[model samples]
Target: MAALEGRGLRKQFGGVVALNGIDLDIDTDQVVGIVGPNGSGKTTLFNVVTGVHPATAGTVSWQGQDITNIGAHRIARKRLVRTFQQAMSFPGLTVDENVRIAWEQGRRGGSRWASPAMILDFVGLAPLGRAIAGSLPFGSLRRLGLAVALGVSPELLLLDEPGAGLN
Candidate 1:
């Protein structure tokens, strides 16, 4: 069974169609990329699959179980997490604190890296752990976001524009 699957997915915002009958399947440990020009439905697909936005039609499943519209929090609890196109973090908090928050709120299933510190190290942000999130450079901010997502120990991570800030 696929770890994540979207069948006939469709999302519409008023008269605008974001996604139209999209079908996708991701197996465990598989790396997939969705590429398109600006204004394409790439982000919309992530939003629907992650439950950040409801699909106008179609079904989403995780491990063969229907997860369509179940809500983003619930999906995250299932160990399915995602990062945004822009670096998303608590600007007022330190890098360490931001990752710690994700650890506290995220699902726990005993990943090899057990703590936020470990996650920061894994993402190559250990030296900057104490820095304010908003003060970091764009690349560092992106890494910080990755560290926070790692804090969740996600089974399947969907990175939206993962290289956006790195370049």
Candidate 2:
């Protein structure tokens, strides 16, 4: 069975049809990229699959289980996590604190990285762990977002525009 599957997925915002009849199957350990022009429904696809937004039609299955519109938090607990296009963090908190919270809130038993520090290191943000999240540069913020997603110990990670703020 595919690790992740979306069949006939469609999302519409009022009259705007963001996705139409999209079908995809991702196998275990497979790296897939969805590329399209601006406003081409890439983010919408991620939102639908990850439960950030409800699909207007179709289904999303993870490990052969129906997970469509199950809610984002529940999906995260299932070890499926995603990053946002915009770098997301608690502005008032230190970088370390932000990651620590992510780890605490989303920590499951099977994380590849053993701790929050490891996740920061993996994203090249260990040195700035003490810095306030709001004070960081754009690229660092993007990396922080990635680190936060990793802190959740996801079995499957969907990164949206991961390279957006980076060189």
Best by TM-score: 2
What's the lDDT for candidate 1? 0.90
Tell me the TM-score of model 1.
0.93
* lDDT per residue as tens, model 2, 18-83: 999999999769899999999999999999999999999999999889999999888878888899
* lDDT score, candidate 2: 0.90
| Per-residue C-alpha lDDT of model 1 across residues 1-167, encoded as one tens digit per residue | 68899999999999999999999999868999899999999999999999999999999999888999999999988988999878889999999999998887664566646678888988889999899999999999999988888887788999998987775
Candidate maximizing lDDT:
2
lDDT of 1 at 157: 93
* Candidate 1 segments whose C-alpha is farther than 4 A from its true place: 105-107
Per-model TM-score on C-alpha atoms: 0.93, 0.95
Per-candidate alpha-carbon RMSD to the true structure: 1.5, 1.2
